[model samples]
Target: MQPTEQPTKTESLKVAVVGTGYVGMGTAVMLASLGHQVVGIDIDQNKIEMLRRGELPIYEPGLEDLLRASQERLRWTGDYASAIPDADVIFICVGTPPLPSGQPNLRYVAEAAQSVARNLNGKLQVVVNKSTVPVGTGDWVSRILEDHALDYSAGRYVVVSNPEFLREGTALHDSLYPDRIVLGSSSPEGIERLRQLYQPLLEQTFTPPEGMPRPANYTLPELVTTSLSSAEMIKYAANAFLALKISFANEIAGLCECVDADIEQVTHGIGCDQRIGHRFLSAGAGWGGSCFGKDTAALINTGSEYGYTMPILRAAVEVNQRQRHLVISKLQRHLHRLQGKRVAVLGMAFKPNTDDLRDAPAHDCIARLMDLGAKVTVHDPVAMPHARREWAHLTYDEAPTAEAALRGADAVILMTEWDEYRALDWDQAVRTMRRRLIIDTRNVLQQLPQHSTVEQVGRTTLHNVPGNEVLAEALA
Candidate 1:
């Protein structure tokens, strides 16, 4: 696969992307690479300035490279008046952070809609809902534009729900090669315009970028057109289902531990059944990111709004929360008491390859460990900078290397499954730690050091040290 240097003039549409976060940034870069002229608009001056200087505000693999590759066709701005007027399509990629009641705070979306409305320049614009919003938000945005925008009688805009399904770490690849493209609106014209805009992706006609090659035997993305509400529901449903899968694995993993069965083997066996394919089944420190947990809660809240109780989704949420606490429980059981204990934590990011720490299991575990009077040190290959910012007030040491975090620690806990953590020298780690105790939460370590005690979630404890038999007897 080779990257394209020049824009292809095949029906290039002028596009404006509002809110240059993960979804917005990826969308803007992808559209430009697909030959559309894209302008990324954001309220954050820092982010806009950074992007304008050919730097990405957020961390995602291959995103900055792809953004640089497609720089000629892409531009970033802080003003809506300059970006939205001449665009053929506008994507609302703003944040919808969860409120205390589990409902998404649509303030950013509302603000973006209002701003886009004020900037409407009488040209027909297909406004897209690229953010994961509650059902009926598409209609709400349309109404907001109708009430606020000038010349409503002139048919200046039509709203469409085009919810993005991009994951944080692999967002750019997901955008370039999506499983499907869903567009929802009452206006057939609005749906058709988006279809045209995504035609290259839908047909897989564009040359694949250098680093991200198209998977062999990969099928073209399915384009699903539906009513506005259904399209919005699809994004929520997909995320909720994936969350359920992970939570379900963790729930069963708890049972596996009790029954002397290995969760890793169990999930592998059931995953081959064809009915339940293998994906998101790895039982670890549960799931955390911008999507799964928030989306599941939103789905449950949406159900409650209509007087329907979604028990399954509620259970998934409960399971995930409980799973994070399991780390604390394991620590307490093995170490007896956490007071005055020095613990080293590896991997602070929710998962690997990105610096996103939103709702990460590591934060909850670290907080509990702190409350229990244990000294904590943390390390991650990429998330350290963000973690330092998020956890500065909380008294915890930040280690530059995994070995530094392991030094002089009573117990080492594997929180995130970064490859760097997976490739640690266990023998040296055992020698460096004050206590020879290791907690493999993610089941990442393939082997353990000789004469060391290792505890894994959903598996039997390994007591390789001679005197550790007493500790095993205590656990028994």
Candidate 2:
């Protein structure tokens, strides 16, 4: 059903969220802001301690401010017993990292469920599956709870699938004003309870938090209720489709490079067709982060269990991997051999406005460059600290600033499109570099720096290789 024409009021609920990572943290804060009493439960003591001290373990826009505003209604703890017993609603938001077989390892989800089951207060409680799990996971979780919980029965508990569709950087905004909220459960009572819990969000009744105003054209979000399996499939299908769109753009960009066409212009032209939206169509270093790679792999693994093959999804993955190598190949074409060359990488986080480095394209690019005997230095506005801790085993210099990273470099690779990188003083950069070369993988530069050899994928670029002056002159 659609949201009401006027704002609807909902009674506050006692909510407990398991796992204090991205989804869990955001959900806990959102619910608390809606006047619900929320306790964020995580096994990680450090994360719990940080949350209690008004510090955030991860980087997400506007989350810290929201958490601070809702501190009175929110609590953080490492002990599940303290948080789970009195909760009217329990959300399982744990991680499902993939295994070597492409299947999601559900050990954490299983553990969390068992813990919640053992602590149940014998009162009616709605257990929600908010983690992105395989299609049949809702039933599996139900079985686990039944096998462990005391006096477990339909009257005492219900399992609901409520998968999240949050992006890493803009997670909080997406949660508060999502386009739709999908709830799946066999019990009508469970769906009604969640609908009441999300009434403020669905009806846009809650006052907007400071520094996070609602969009001008915003409308109330729809509430979609489905069977447990359909809700699980929705999350995987949505992510796989987005991954496919990015891979499609990259594949087209490769062809654009061959035929002297510009991907920026091509995407813009095609995006106007209405059938294909403009989002996720920009071609550059292919997508990276936790969700796209993990979700796509898990979706493919699900197909294999039923003896089905996903050729299109498999091709999309291959295309994404190829984009990473394309960066190395482009550098080699310009400089011939990378041995002893001073190369600087501009962004390390998989994407801008975040400190997440999982499966980032820059990782593959830096590794290949270092292996080719090139000296590599990397810089990101907020990711350097996390990179130092996670990627310390790799031998690479960490530049304190973008300018510092560019100094004396033979070539520069723009990996992530940060505002600071986009607004860089290219004139100053050209003067300090040993060789004026840039590989604009993100296509973010406004104008190409004069007298510099810049190679951009899917666009005609100048080559400054020795004895290619005639070709350079013609292109200019």
Best by TM-score: 2
Candidate 2 per-residue lDDT over residues 1-476, each given as its tens digit? 44345655679999999998889999999999999999999989989889999999999999999999999999999888898989999999999999999898999999999999999888889999999999989999999889999878865789999999888888888998898899999989899889989989988888888988787778888789999999999999999999999999999999998987778889999999899989999899899998899999999988989999999999999999999999999999889999999999999999988899998999989989989999998999999888888888688998989889989999999999999988988877777899989999988875556678888877777654556655444443
Give the residue spans of candidate 1 off by over 4 A: 1-9, 465-476
lDDT of candidate 1 over 32-144, digit per residue (tens): 99999999998889998898899988789999888899999998889888998899999999999999999999999999999999989887799999999999999999999
Per-candidate TM-score against the hidden true structure: 0.95, 0.96
Candidate 1 has a TM-score of: 0.95
RMSD of 2: 2.8
Candidate 2 segments exceeding 4 Å error:
1-8, 463-476
Candidate whose lDDT is highest:
2
Q: Report the alpha-carbon TM-score of model 2 versus the true structure.
A: 0.96
